[model samples]
Target: MATRCDAIVIGSGQAGPFLAARLAAAGRHTVLIEREHLGGTCVNDGCIPTKTMVASARAAHVVRRAAEHGVTVGGPVGVDLRAVKARKDRVVAQSVDNLTQWLTNLPNLRLIRGHARFVGPREVKVGGETLAAPQVFINVGGRALHPDWPGIGEVRVLDNTSMMTLETLPEHLVVVGASYIGLEFAQMFRRFGAQVTVLEAAERAVAREDPEVSRELQSILEREGVAFHFGVRGAKVARSADGGVHLALNAAGVAREIDASHLLAAIGRRPNTHDLGLERAGIATDARGFITVDDQLRTSVEGVWALGDCNGRGAFTHTAYNDHEIMADNLLAGAQRRVSDRIPAYALFTDPPLGRIGMSEAEVRAMQKPALVGVLPMSRVGRARERGETQGFMKVLVDARSERLLGAALLGIEADEVVQTLLLAMQADLPVSLWRRSVPIHPTVSELLPTLMAQLKPLEEIPR
Candidate 1:
């Protein structure tokens, strides 16, 4: 007999687990499938593990400056790479185990461990066992894309997944992208005493962000000893006789050679669309291989939905959680949800982390809106000076006529936390006057909100 389910979720990643749990809580017979670990890449290879490494790097960085904190160490501060990896593994395992135990207790949800392929519409075959469900959700996430560079396969190269498993950090690590993953790993390894160099094909790193933010980040990274080769159109890699990798970068009609102990390919990510047999189920995918879904996340085929990285809908774990929330409501509560034109916030966890919500100055101008821009240096904030993190700035843009916050960009300590407040201001259509009137705790970075507002002038009078 084919195992039947009220709802079947393929790929037990962020979206899959989330929706499955919701469905089971709603008393639906749900089954979640996973070919590997339960927590998916975020826990196993992506967010959790990467953040753990960042925490380790942060500890090392802080310990080096412990003297500034008036703490005297008796001996030399050192790190054991083996112990770090051990702790990372332990953390990953504990989270996965907790999730497994929680899911196991849900009587309405069954966990299946095997590779699944579409046998037909509404039917999947897992290792020779056929399962059927009326409604199916595809949530397989993305994988790091490895570009075709000559001699790449012959040399020691690592993708985002393989990079996190490093027992001993490389002496010289070359990163091949300027995206979030590339930038974060490059800095972390460099802080761990590796010679780190970032190669970006674009004119600037983090091109998706505002130019000012990118420039500030570049300055910070360069000050911290990470070298960047920008405007490189292509690269060729060859193995040196001494076990190092030689990279020939083509930029400005010239080729330059760089040697590094290991190369990291963080160019981008590709949706895991193959082997699931989308065509068998009569589903459609975009040219880039992302599954196409309507506003409700419903695919062309009825009773089928796709979410998370597989749908190419902003590859963040939080977005996946949101997708699950909206998807469950659409599925069970008969609510119509559309993921269009949302006020999403993003953070780049570099030194003096960068965070942003909504449009940039360029974007606002290109859209032909009169944008009033305001900026205040972190130096002006009392807390920034006291905490010795007076580098960077806070900026806010408001529509000239409506005085509501159109966007905000923060680059400094606690940027990740501060961005949420900005997000709320934007969502609630709050004005800069409100921000000015609100009193934040004294001697805190949050007070920079009013500090920035004090420097604003109307955009109408500014001469172009």
Candidate 2:
């Protein structure tokens, strides 16, 4: 007999698993099919493994600067690359086990591992098994996009998938692209004793962010001995006579050569929409291979939905989790949840760790708003002095007319936790003055908030 279900989820990543669990808990027969691991990229490759490795890299960085805090170990600090890889692997394995157990324990959920292809409307074939359902959700995430370049196959190049498993550190590494992945690996590898050179096609690193934040990041990375070639385009790689590789790049009108022991490509990720039989299911995809969905995450076809990286809205795991929740409520309880008012946040795990939420200075200008900007250098904060970490700044952008907090960027200690407070303020449309009046905990990095609020003035008044 052909297995029947009320809903079938095509991938078991952050969005797929959460949605599957939600549908099953609502008494719908939900089956989740995956071509790979249960937790998808977040647990398997993207978030869990990278963050775990980043944690070790951060610890290594802390040990090197430990004397400032008056804490000293007996001997010189050492980093064991093999041990770091072992620990990252352990964390990934534990996450997979937990996800597997959760799905198995769900009463109305069944997990299947195989490539699923749509055979017809509301029907799919997973290898030899055929399944039919009233509603089908495609949560298929993405993989690292490898563009065709000269010597692409001849030279060893690592993407996010293979980079974390590296046991030995290269003496010199040439990283392509200055996006999130490239910036992250570049910083981590440099801290791990690799002479890192980042090649960015864009004029600025993290061109999507505020110009001030991008400039600050470049300055910070340069201070840490990472070389960068900004405004460079068209990179070609060739194998050197020896065991190394030579990278030739065209920057504007000039050509430059870069030699390194290892090459990493972190350009970007493309949606995995091809060969999914979407054409057969009458699903529509845009030019970028992203599925087109409405505000409710519903495709043109009724009872069919798409979420996460597949939709290309925001690829963060937390964003996908929220997408899953919204989709579930829209499907089951008829709740109308627009993706607006979303405080989608990101944290770049660098030396001091930069965290951002909501709009930026550039975005506010683009919207033609009278932007009031406040910048509070961490050096002035009492907690920064106490913690001996005063290398970065906290900046806040506000709508001068509305007096509401627009966005915030923090580049200092505990930025990841600090962004959450800003997230709440932005989500609730809280006034910037509220932060100034409310007394923050004494001798904490968070005290920068009140200090920054007090410095609020016109964007023009902010000194560069």
Candidate 3:
């Protein structure tokens, strides 16, 4: 016999819990099934723990530069890896606990602590119980991708999740990917007194960014004592005699070897839908195993939906949360919110973070769209100059005809928060002139936006 509910939410990721709460509040009997921690990746491994450590790293970085701020500190600054891990653990625990409490108190929601698998079109198996629900939402999320490299099985390798658990700092950390995750960890560990090197198979770090942005970021990280090997091929890994890991790669047909105390495989992430028995439920997935869904997050099977990284639409936590909102609005509020309506945006949490929204200049150019471009260096920003952190620049793209914002990227201090202003402008369909004329608070990183917009030039003026 199977226990039945009105709705079943799988994996307690960003989307699952919020959707479950909405269903329960709508007087529906909802079951929220979680195989691991209640708050999933964001609270447990991805955002909370990593950002907490990044904060510690930032503190160390600032303290080391205290002299620049006219604040004389003690002789030398140091990092205690154990203490850093402890603080991250506490932050994760608090977030998980708060989410667990909220879920437990939901009146009509049942929180199941076990793995779930689809047993039928409308039924799932978890533990010794069979649960059936007409409406099933899969938010199983994703996990770190493991590459099949030589000696990978023989040597100890760390992924993003396991790296956070390391109690001792590595003397030399070799990162396998130069994406956002790899770069963040590279900088964080470097600040923690590690000699870090990053290897990327792509031609450049962050291949998706504009070439100039990629070069600027690489320069910044390189200046911070991080070595990078790009356009690498035929990479192999092995254990050295001293028990350290050795990575050999071919760069432009030349063989090179790098020995490091630890190896972090920050290649990418994969959807966690392998063992879900999607075939039993008639659910379709793409070649990468990400569940296929329409703009409204609807799966092939009626009354079933997939959200979060599992669906392959957007992998960020914010996008996952927005998926829940879209589902709730369409299903419960008689609204037509859609996944396609969202403007892509994300932030890299490096010291001088990179905040990005909409298309990149390369992307716009690829579409052959007429664009107006503007750029301002952090050196011109009063606040960045005062803070002595002027290292990057801000760029904005506008439609040449409408003067409407097409995209924006801020790669300087407080960029993560400052990018939101342009996001809102894009969302509201505001013209570039409006942003140019708007009076922002003086002496702030964001206030430079107006001045930046004042420098808008034809896209043809952009240096190749």
Quote each prediction's TM-score: 0.96, 0.96, 0.99
Candidate 2 on 23-120: residue-level lDDT in tens? 99999999999998888889999999998988898888788888877888777767788999999999999999998998999989998989999888
Ranking by TM-score: 3, 1, 2
Candidate 2 segments exceeding 4 Å error: 71-76, 252-254, 460-464
TM-score of predicted structure 2: 0.96
Best model per lDDT: 3
lDDT per prediction?
A: 0.85, 0.86, 0.92
Give RMSD to native, each candidate.
1.7, 1.8, 0.9
Q: Cα miss at 82, model 2 (Å)?
A: 1.4
Cα error, candidate 1, residue 307 (Å): 0.9
Q: Tell me the tens digit of each residue's lDDT in model 1 across 110-157.
A: 999988888778888888798999999999898988868777877878
Regions of candidate 1 where Cα sits further than 4 Å from its true position: 74-76, 458-464
Rank all candidate structures by their lDDT, best first, as comma-separated numbers. Answer: 3, 2, 1
